[model samples]
Target chain A: MTPFSYTRAGDAADAVRLGAFGGAKYLGGGTNLVDLLRETIERPSALVDVAGLPATIEEREDGSLLIGAATRNAALAEHRAVRSHYPVLARAILAGASAQIRNMATVGGNILQRTRCAYFYDDEGSRCNKRSPGQGCDALDGFNRIHAILGASADCVATHPSDMCVALAALDATVHLQGPAGTRRLKLTGLHRLPGTRPDLETALEPGELITAVELPALPAGARSTYRKVRDRASYAFALVSVAAVLEADSGTVREVRLALGGVAPKPWRARKAEDALRGGPATVQAFRAAAESELADAAPLRDNGFKVELAKRTITAVLGDLAGVAA
Target chain B: MAIRINGTETRAPADPRVSLLDLLRETLHLTGTKKGCNQGACGACTVLADGERILSCLALAVQFEGRSITTIEGLAGQDGMHPLQLAFIEHDGFQCGYCTPGQICSAVGMAAELARGAPSAVTTDLGAATVRFTGEEARERMSGNLCRCGAHNGIIAAITQTYAGAAL
Candidate 1:
């Protein structure tokens, strides 16, 4: 790892000030950042440790939840309110990573974690556009089984590896930010950008911007939600294709739905088209499959990842059908 | 700031790049914690941070200033080996024994998590106030720590026996 100076931020202002310095990165839990440092993929001159900042999960009187960015992933998953109200978020967190990593990883860090593409991590052999812009992408041609099928540019075909963010996207969560320019908010769906010409520019976050908290608006009283991840093996593996959905049905008719997909896009792919198609429609396996097909209509798969399109569609249908009590 | 390890106040390494695993094994000469994959893939360096299990290899020494860390060496008191350690020996829970320290420490932390109702991926009822420690739960919670020796069956038996009746 490169030699660097580490300073624990006293507050949000102090963290922002120290982080704004060139080549400085905010350290949260150090799960991904530490690995990247050892790999020399990230060579920051200094690290602003923000893991000790506000790590609380506040329940608002209006039924909304305000989760501090520094809150440990385990704590968030174990919170009573989160388990009772937003079971999908808790399940999603528990589904990803081991219990040990979850205990160490923070919410903000989970949101900012980089892709798990082998090409991106092969700093020695492979040329990655995300690792070094204007370079080329190896995943586009080489063993691209896990490459993105949606929202991927020709320059990069990597997919985001977060399972929690997929649930947050379906929950319509809002991320609160504090930076040198003051505070602002961005919807979770809008925070991550597609792998356009510049894959290095991943998030909407400006340099030195700190994620303070993530707020989840109240879910409908009758809505039921769940997250389903399909991987090679159970536990401790990233999702090949995952679905997070919140369904509200009234006497076999879909009232409202929020859906998002993971491991198939550059960012958390919100299936807005499927949600639009499912709303007010009869809740059945056929309807679910049609809605899923509609969402994947524009998916352009790579040579090795064409199977993901069908796998994603089936997983989405199964998850929605299970929620709707429809048997295949 | 100094980090408390095994109830001792040990000064942290000055170099910001030293991981907690390296600090334990290299700096303080506490080699009980093993380093498997330097990255977060393998949890051979699993240790207790404030009673919660964490991968020490992924933790920077400077980031854990003033916190309490408990490794495999810290599990047994002056009163002999920890019960989990004894159970591991009885069940022959290890072959090469490279991943034993991590498995024991991780099981210790897992018992605490289950006692507090921290659910795992295999946990069916998220809304339940308490979780039952079954073989399935142990497998899911310990998935981070990989054992190439294929000693998982015996490891699970030892953990199950040692932590019996821990769940509410």
Candidate 2:
């Protein structure tokens, strides 16, 4: 690791002030940043520790969950309110790294975790545009098994590896951020950007901006939600294809539906068309299958990831069927 | 930086870049905590902070000021070993023992979580305040601690036996 200065921030203001300076990064939990620093993936001049920020789990007046930025993943997953109301989020967090990692990983750090692209981690193996701008991408043709099939560009095909972000996008969670300019809120789905021109700018967070909290709105009554992640191993492995779905079936008809996919796109892939197709339709296997098919119609698979198209479709169908109370 | 390790308070030079794993092993001579991956992926350097398990590999020594830390050596008492430690010994829950400290510390924290009614990802009822310590729950909770010796079956059996009669 490179030599750097470290200072503990007193509060959010102190963190923002220190982070606003050039080549300074806010440290939270240090689960991802520490590893990145050691690997030379991230080399900041200074680290401003924000673990002491006054953050907690609280319920707003409108029955929404407000998760503080510094709240540990373990705390959020084990919170009574989160387990009872937002079971999908809890399930997503539990499906992540592990009990020990979850204990030290904070909500803010989880949201800001970088992609697990092999090329990006390798400083010399393959030239990654995300790691070094304008250098080119090696995952475009080499070992593209885990590359994204949707919302990808010629410059970068790396997929987002967050299970919790997929669930948050499907639930319409809001991220509250504070920067040197002030505070702003962005919808979770809009927070991420497509690899349009600059594949390096992954999130909408400005420089020196700190994520303060994440607010999850309450779901409708009688809504069934689930998060299914498919990986090579049972635990402690990144997702190969993950689906987060929330469906409401009223009297044999689909009332409302929300779907988002992970490990398949540059950002969380929200199935807007699939949700529209399911709304007001009969809750049957045929409808679920059709929705899943329509969602992946525009997927552009790489050489090794063509199988993910079928796997994602089947996973979505199974999840939606289970949520809609339909079975084979 | 002042921190408590294994019931003893100690201070180290203000070196923020030193990882907690290195501080324990090199500075304090607590070499029981192994460094398998040097990253957070492997739990070979697991330790207890205020009775909760954390990855000391990624933890900065400066961030742990005034916190209580426990390693494998702290598991035994004047009388005998902890229940989980004895169970591990009797069950032969290790082969090379490189990851034994981490497994023991993680199991200690996991047993506490089970006693506190924490649910695992495989738990069917999320609303259920109390989750039973079934075999599946134990497996899912201990998935983070990897053992190359393939002693998982024995480890699971030992943890089950230790927590079987407990209220967790």
Best by TM-score: 1
How do the residues A158-261 of candidate 2 rate in per-residue lDDT, one tens digit apiece? 99888889999999999999999999999999988998768999999999999999999989978888899999898888888999998889998999899999
Estimated TM-score per prediction?
0.99, 0.98
C-alpha RMSD (angstroms) for model 2: 1.2
Candidate 1 chain A — worst ten consecutive residues by lDDT sum? A319-328
lDDT of 1 by residue, A91-145 (tens): 8999999989999999999999999999999999999999999999999889999
TM-score of chain A of each: 0.99, 0.98
Please tell me the interface RMSD, in Å, for model 2: 0.9
lDDT of 1 at B39: 93
Q: List DockQ, one per candidate, in order.
A: 0.94, 0.85
Q: Rate the local accuracy (lDDT) of all candidates.
A: 0.93, 0.89
